[model samples]
Target: MATAPVAEAVSLDHRLGDVVVRLEFADDGPVRLVGLVSADAFDASRPPRPRVTPLVELSFAGESHVRHSHGTRHRNYAATSRLRLVERVADARRLSVTQRDPETGLVVVTTIESTTPTTVAIASHVTNEGAGPVAVEYLSSLVLGGFAEAVEADVFRRLRVHTCLMAWTAEYRWRDESLADVGLVDAGIPHPTSSTRTSYSFGALGSWSTGTHFPQGAVQDRESRQLWMWQLEHNGPWNAELDDVGRDVALSLSGPTFRQHHWSQQLLPGESFSSVRAVVAPVVGDVDDGIAALTGHRRAARAAGAVELPVIANDYMNCLMGDPSTEALLPIIERAAAVGARIFVVDAGWYADDAGWWSTVGEWRESRARFPNGLVEVTRRIRDLGMIPGLWLEPEVMGVDSSALGDLPDEAFFRRAGRPVAEQGRYHLDFRHPAVRSRLDAVVDRLVAEHGIGYFKLDYNVNIGEGTDVDASSLGAGLIGHERAYLAWLEAVRERHPGLLLENCASGGMRADPAQLGVTDLQSTSDQEDPVLNAMIACAAPSVIVPEQAAVWSYPQPHYSDDLNDFTMIQSVLTRVHLGGRLDLLSPAQLARVKAALSVHASLESFIPAAVPFWPLGLPGWQDEWLALGLRSGQRSVVAVFRRGGTATVLLPLEGRATILHPIDRGARVSEEPNGLAVTVPATPGAVVLDLIG
Candidate 1:
């Protein structure tokens, strides 16, 4: 492979046990990039899949699989990568490359989207041929340069790629791998793969083999720096494929020279195989951070191109009461001015999407029965109160009642005409069409100009569907075209509402990838209602994102239950306190308590969001009765702690004397140490404070 002559380029270094970045630009255009995966990363035990075989003439193990369209194999290859590239040929500025896996027969596809000469967008898809009953897994080792230091390497700036989280089809929460109907376990985050430094593993998902291994010393492309490994298993799956979404994206990557694993979902003969598109551009920082910086670069590019935006919010799956009535929002809007909450969000209900709010999205209408006066009145109330009203929208899907039903082409969907496509909640939108793009733009424009929605909560939690949803005749046409459509939509909206705040969701966390980082201002942690879960998320969130963007919401109750306690309630709103819990539907006294809690949070949040340089103050969360986040801004520091009681003696990590707040009574006391002060919590109460040290 010929290496491009190097000019000033992005570089990497390490900080706080992680990687840091320094991106320098190429003089003329993006630096040409490619992958050099070490053969050592591949197990000597497994065989590699075939390569660069033309998609039109696939001869898998000499067993020819004919391309079928309209119930006929009109051509030897109906949908191939060669055809996929044609979709994006017109947009040369967009990333235009794809590749395949050498082992595991998993089809690997990618696309490079460069918003700037220095920044590039990388999108990858990995699938299998549903060949032999095989288990497929993925592991991409992004080797850094020789000038990089490994000790200080850290992953910074992660954004949500997919943000929509759906309540399970049957389970109230998530399953270990798939959905299970009968269990109280929301299993909010199922462990798909156990974390290991050397080898990452994952459980079986919809179609592929489940885990990946991380080799500790596989940072190739350098002769100096030693490498470390961070193995990961798939958390679960979030498919955006509607019928053939995966196939469409795959066909666009290149020809069918991929490693694949085949399996039967049931005892029946079921297979899962895919193709991919790709491009590798030299980027800065650790791999994750590089992705974030590039995403920011792209958003900036579009902003420079004139994308108009207004900030907004929407109450979604967690805070929903299943009604979109104006009255449902009275309390939230009522408090807007006081807390300076700029936007009042009403999720799901306002639009007459399907028979209910959860399915059949994209229809735009006011449910008169739900909102008696109309959304116009609701917006008036919000504006009158000096806040903007935002609506939650799932433009990527259509329900059974969608007007576009049976009216659109088959190429827009993932399933074959009669094949079993994963149609769990609704029909996934085919963003591959310009017509669809225009309709969506119109929807946003009308909503913003007329009803006055300042924000859009775009949630896409389910997995991408297969590309077979469209007619077999138009196979693969949706490939790269689909990506262009999505980017165009975002670019247009930014040009339209350059400052509009968009909250992205993909089943909550699945969509938070680097490509969409700064494109979205606020991001969620997870759709967790439990403080235990919230505490768990808190431990990890500061490592990647700013606190303000985390979904650190806690209610006075268990979100769905009335079992409330002062300790439990405080536990709920500690991070990003929305003080939300069916607010319009809360008891009078309970509502009062919520306001009180918010008041306390108001004081603490300033510290929480700005309290950088945090350290775990004596392993606080391990106490089933306690939860805390400790921070240091300079020499001055404070630790927010709440105890569930039981003569607990918590260790203080601070060396200097500090003052502490007695969680109860909002009282304060100075510590008596040799130097100044260091405090501890009283047995049954909690504490918040101003800690000072010399």
Candidate 2:
């Protein structure tokens, strides 16, 4: 096909029902698009946010194509469409589309522009002419060749499906070849992570979904269901979906309460409709060939940009500890490295003798009995164990009796003439003060030079309050000064340890926003022990905009509600980003439980940034108190399932023909089928494994 010149006549409008798609671009530039919008209903009480697909690039045979039609699910409809219209009106030969609707009084106009070879933009606009206000829904979807599945596959989310209706929100069961007709169930229904993610929101809607996708022959007969983007609910790949949980969330759902993603809309009188234009780009294409086509951003950030350092995972028992001494966690640290713990950190209590004395901030020194060998011996031991040694510190804190605040010159602190420091009854540090900065710099330099510290779990116990102790009229930023001190510490630390990973903890989510996250590497997910609640933390994890890290509880805890079996299953399905748990504290059987959990953890831990790559709606009682469940990730696909304690029927989410490997009573069984995988497992409360086989 010959190309159109920059001065060529451009096609301007196209329509689809209530939507009028427009196209435009510059003669010497690439395509640009706009989506004039509307909503399904018009009421000021509930305003709707219209959706639009402003820029979509189509590709064919791994290259750009230029043709389009609504009904075909082949080639690339966004970039390679035969018509270079959406973003390339400059090259369009003839573009025309029309739509009629009572809600839209303006004639739907679409403009197509082709600014250069293989680049186009198509936009839709509806001018409100006759109606007072109209609400409209945005309709923009792309048909790109396999990048959707490719990125998913590259990320290892290939669940081969043979069903079309793809039960968007249905529950499924496992299969049993020995039992008549029972071979149709899959051990893991929907997807593994869906049970947790859907309840939380993390800003953008990216590579997330739920459903049954089975690798061919992986399972001969499991049904697949719940197929769509939103089904898997964590914010795309390599995201901190569970780590920075509490900080960045748009909505949340725990019980029967249904939080709408977004519904209804309001169109201002004579203002037409509010619209949002979306650019649909393939997440995976040849990175070399598709970066420009997809992200519009060139090369990726330097692969080695982040400073590499191991981080410690505690204040010992975490927030609950009034005294870290009682926890006996130091011994666990040595034992951890013995079993492969790479980063060793001495938690909170290591500072003040008790929590009440935590404000002794500026005077950080090793407590006596906690480490009789002194901090040096501990670091030596960590080195002997072949792991990097790290520690925890809340340099931003100050106690009334501490030397940094109580004894320091009043000129060195943040103080006001008469107002009480709102939150912290004690005084605060003046971060901007040159002396304060020098103090922190000395600490970091001392730690690095003396103990070979690998990482720092920088902690902030409380938000310092502005108090009369600070001469506010003359002492700038009484309370905020403390915050500024933290920033200075962060900048100094990075400047010192550019390759060190910084873990941020400000009473959990207090400072877990973008500004702080950009300076830190990892953040804890939550304080909750129950996987369900922790999952809520994981749901909000990725919104932090940093490296993904969700603190997973591994030890089979002696809790009130769960027995060994139930807890084991839940632990496996819990967040992937984790720090090893307290195996030394559990019972003997729970010790064995640690090994069991370790096997699963070992396989998935390194890939946590991938997060829950695949997840579909789970068993109906999953959110309820059902005790039996299982998940299987093998060769190319994964099969998971859930069943009630007394309910006899178990539904599987495997689709089409498959061959499976399962754990039966006497031993293991492997079988093949035309549609899906086949399996037979002993009706017990444990995982049944199956490799995706031919």
Clash totals for all candidate models:
104, 120
For every candidate in turn, the CA RMSD to the true structure comes to 13.2, 16.7
TM-score of 2: 0.48
Could you tell me every candidate's TM-score relative to the true structure? 0.57, 0.48
Off by over 4 Å in 1: 1-320, 336-340, 353-355, 404-407, 417-422, 465-488, 557-577, 584-626, 631-638, 642-647, 656-694
**In model 1, what lDDT does residue 537 have?**
47
Candidate lDDT values, in order: 0.40, 0.36
| Candidate 2 Cα lDDT to native | 0.36
Once model 1 is optimally superposed onto the true structure by TM-score, how far is the C-alpha of residue 329 displaced, in angstroms? 2.8
Question: Which lDDT value does model 1 have at 468?
Answer: 33
lDDT for residue 467 in candidate 1, whole number 0-100: 38
Cand. 1 Cα-lDDT: 0.40
Tens digit of lDDT per residue, candidate 2, span 1-694?
2233335434233332222333343343223232211112112242222111223322211222232322221222332222232222222233433332332343344433322222222334444455554432221222111211112212113222111111112212222121112111222323321111121112211111111210000111112211111111111111101111111111111100001121112233454321121122111212111112211110011123323223233434322243444236556665565444567666666656555665455577766666566777767766787877777777654666676554445566554554324235444556656776777778777888788887777766544321223433212113323443555578778877876666665554434433354456665534444444333233323222222343433333444123333333333333433344453454555444444444544554433333222322222222432222222233343333322233433334344334332222323243454543344333333333332321
